[model samples]
Target: MIAKSPLRVLVAPNAFKGTFSAFEVASAMAAGVRRALPEAQITCLPLADGGDGFRATLVAAGGGRTSRHRASGPLLEPVWARVGWLPGRSGETAVIELASVAGLARIARPSPHTAATASTRGLGELIRAGLRGGPAEILVGIGGSASTDGGAGLARALGYRLLRADGCEIPEGGLGLRQLHRIESDRVDRRLAGVRVLAASDVTNRLLGRRGAAAVYGPQKGADRATVAGLEAGLHRLAEVAGRDLGTSGLEARPGAGAAGGTGFGLLAFCGARLFPGADLVANACGLDGALAQADLVLTGEGRFDRETVPKHCAIVSIAQRAAPNGPGSPGAL
Candidate 1:
């Protein structure tokens, strides 16, 4: 009889929301795998969907380092934010996750007033800091944001003057959008012109209308009906101005444009950034495909695994299915 080779196992998991992080989950799963297969070769790849844990996950996977900077929070308060750095052969890459600064989690309590006043200016500040490092690429994970200002605050942070009809700067947050009229990009940071900006998001909503950021996500952030309506109008005005001043028209209808309270739209319009699937971007950065190619068995999970877990859209499930013995590469079993 032929002897079988020891199993090569890969354990990759997403965070169990409201519980452990992806790194912690990966560690716990690795321990369980060790107990079950004492002699198996195990590999762990922690995963994220471009939200709260994105920076940590990528940094851990790439042996990158992190630096903290004081930035504005969702409520315009001072907060310490961390940016991940990954050195490459050519130049370094910076990973900036919006959750670190503008996430809803930063809010102690959700209220209509807080939702209306939340701003993504801090996220823009983080990006500006990252740019100072002279990175070749900036990977912005726009999820878990608390603002609906259409990236107006971000533009302001990067030196774009979002002025009112009277030529004065608007206030911060969604309410500020009401006064937004024109954008002056002449003062935008020159560094942005040389760096490639990529926005990671799974959202497909547009920047306006029913499926827009304010309409779909504002209520979740504590916005009332009236607040949502107001935010919607504000975002519409912002989009019109962005189109006219920045020549970035039709961005409001783009997929992922509504993510992070329309910060995605802001990034696209003002920074000339491109959008990508969060999972795919994270997976590639972690080299999951290479690991899958060598695995004989793969185990993947998240906090909740349900029928919504499909091979196409679900990150963990997709990784597992792709590593299956009958899957594309046909190398592993899951």
Candidate 2:
């Protein structure tokens, strides 16, 4: 008699950066899973921990569709980025990845040495595109950004105003932070409120600190020592202004606070969003638990799994393994 086939398995992993994208990694692992059990079912969920190539991963993993848009890049040029959606007749629901328009690829140099002149205005445009569809909310994936302007460009895209103390409009990019003093929101697009806002991120860095956006990530965005200091100062000022205007202590050190070049702070201040690890957000979006509930065994891996990956990068996998109803619930068991 033929042996019973092994049970179905789910393959999910984040992008490997320089090595393999999330899609490629999931595909490769699926191949291995198939090799081991040809008759068994295998599901591939190419995951993004709020990093590069998130849009494609979400589209592929969740049967979502994609559309292209032209948005501003780090260098002020028109760049092509895709927005993903879970296909349906419903008005509109979008999955946006910041890397599409304002990612590091647009930067001219490596961190601490490169320019932080990129703008997230393109992300704002993408959000606007989703809004045009009449969606209830836009889930924004914030990762791999190339800007340190605290989402000023994004604010501009949504019709919010950033101005200098003299009331002149601030220019785009991190450099503009130096002159910003007043923020005007009376003209902000009301359509933004029609849909709720959610930011997907994996980092926990605050808006300003030793572990803040500028000090921790400025080097990666081509900021030098002097630039980091200047950027930090600017971020502090932005936080202060937002705090004074909003009349709240605000969460400068909240977990995932240092996301998307401190765009996390802006979103919290302007959009009143709750942030989560990109993986957890995507997992819920894909019904990870539903899949795991049907599985007898599972397999998961990352590029170079380590201690840091457990809490920082691979936290989703760990969470899934723990939530699985197994007696000995641990990632190692999987």
Candidate 3:
């Protein structure tokens, strides 16, 4: 009789929020697999979908270096954020995570007022700090943001002035967007000229209406019914003004515009950024597809399962679909 080959299992998982890191989750999964099948070969791949652990995962996969810089937090408070730098021929590729600077977790308390006042200034500051090194490209993992200010604060950090009708700078956060009059462009960051900014995210909503940023994400950020309405109006004003002045009119309608409380829209309007699926980006960077080809089974998961988690953009489902050869475009996984 011919001997059978041991089953090859690829164990991968995203971070479990407060419970455990992705690496820890993978380790636990690998241990369980070992107990179930002692002879099976297992490989652990910790995944990050542009959330809290994004920088670490990418750094390990790309063999990158890191630096720490003081930047504004989600509430505009100072925070020491880590920035990742990957090697390249002309210049280093800067990797930044929105969660590191403007994530909802940065906030200790959740309230309607704070939600309206959160800012993304830190993200833009990180980008500017990265440019100080003269990077070739910038990869921003934009999600888990606490701000709903339509990235006005991020624009502010990049040198654009969010002014009121009297030319005074507007306040911070989503509510402050209502007072936005015109955006001053002359002082906009000049370093953004040739840099390619890719906003890696999975959100598909636009910048306005029901599926837009405010309607979908405002509540999660602590907006009540009244606050949600206010945020919506503010975002509308911002979109119109940015369209007229920054020439980002139609980009607001594109998918992912609503991501991270309109941070995606802000990057698009101000930085000439392109949106990509975060999981796919990380998976490709780690060569998950190449490993998939050598595996007999792939096991993956995240912190929890929800309607959107399984059907839409959950990291586990993405890799599972990649492992399913019977499905179209299922040749690989991460």
Candidate 4:
């Protein structure tokens, strides 16, 4: 019954969380497959859900290059972050992951104070650097963020001024939103006018309410009950100001608006970026369907694979189903 010559095997897996990158996981799986079937033809396609390892996964799959820059961190400290680039017919396409610069991983020990003061200014600086390359499209992965600033700090870094009632600039982070303010966007980077921006996220929480960023993710970030309540109030105030001053109404209720501590709302409001599911965006960019077409046997895994491993909206599960033996035109079709 063992009549097979060479099996076309596809190995795709998410990162092992804090232990290994997606690339490393794929490589390890590929190696194991090679050991079992020396003649098997294996294709490695690492995947991510837009939390971390997003940039590396995309770059590896797309054959892109990585560039590093020193930018502001969650605590306004300096950190070296990476941006991915892939050259195309139209121009270069840039991939930026918020976790690279503004993620909670940057904080050694997260506390209520750290959560209260974390900022997204570094993310804006990174975007500016990406724009300097004259990219046709910018793909931003907004997840694993430490701050809940409603993107005010990011907007300010990109030239939008957040002025208080007294005409003074507010401090950084969610705490600053307590001051009633107006937004000025005349100074926003002109390069972004023609560039297309796409934000990839995994969550679909709105900007305010029980499922909002502050309520859903605040405790994990070290925000106490009172702090979470303050953040919710601040975000509500920010929504009002942004709606009035910048005309970005209705974003507060938009899905994924609360992602990355409301950086999703900021991108939609300030940069006009459209949000998409991170797994789907990454799958399309990596040409997963095309790879599956040629796969005789498809393999997918993560550090922990459980009932919750593949959510209803996860593209990875869809890919696996499409490549199943019972699926149409699969290599194992009878």
* All models, RMSD in angstroms: 2.5, 2.9, 2.2, 2.8
Per-prediction TM-score to the true structure, in the order listed: 0.91, 0.87, 0.94, 0.91
The better-scoring model by TM-score among 1 and 3 is: 3
Q: After superposition, how far is residue 321 of candidate 1 from its true place, in Å?
A: 5.9
Q: Which residue segments of model 1 deviate by more than 4 Å?
A: 304-314, 324-334
Q: Pick the candidate with the highest TM-score.
A: 3
Q: Per-residue lDDT for 52-149 in model 1, tens only?
A: 68999889889999999999988889999999999899899999999889888888789899988899999899999999999999999897788889
What does the lDDT read for residue 39 in candidate 3? 98
- Residue 325 of model 2 has an lDDT of 51
Per-residue C-alpha lDDT of model 3 across residues 277-326, encoded as one tens digit per residue: 88888888888878777777777777777776753454776687667864
lDDT of 2 by residue, 1-334 (tens): 9987667677766777657887888789889878878877887766677777677766776687888887777666888888788665654568888887778866655664334566778888888877777776677888888888787788888888888988888877776778778788888788887677888887777888898888878887788888888888777877777777655356776777678788887777777777877777767766777766656556665666655455563535544655555565322224
Per-residue lDDT for 1-334 in model 4, tens only?
8886799998877777667878898899899999999999999888887878889888877889988999999999999999899878999889999988999888889888888888999999999999998999998989789999988778888899898998998889897798857888889999998899999987788999998989988887889998888888888999999999989899999999999899999999999999998888888878887888888877776565566445533545656655674456674411
Cα shift from native, residue 326, model 2 (Å): 1.6
Q: Model 1 clash pairs? A: none
**Local error of candidate 2 at 248, Å?**
5.2
Cα lDDT listed for each candidate: 0.86, 0.74, 0.86, 0.85
* Error at 90, model 2, angstroms: 6.8
Instruction: Give me the displacement of residue 250 in model 1, in angstroms.
Output: 0.5
Judged by lDDT against the true structure, how good is candidate 2? 0.74
Please report, as a residue range, the 10-residue window in candidate 1 with the lowest summed lDDT.
306-315
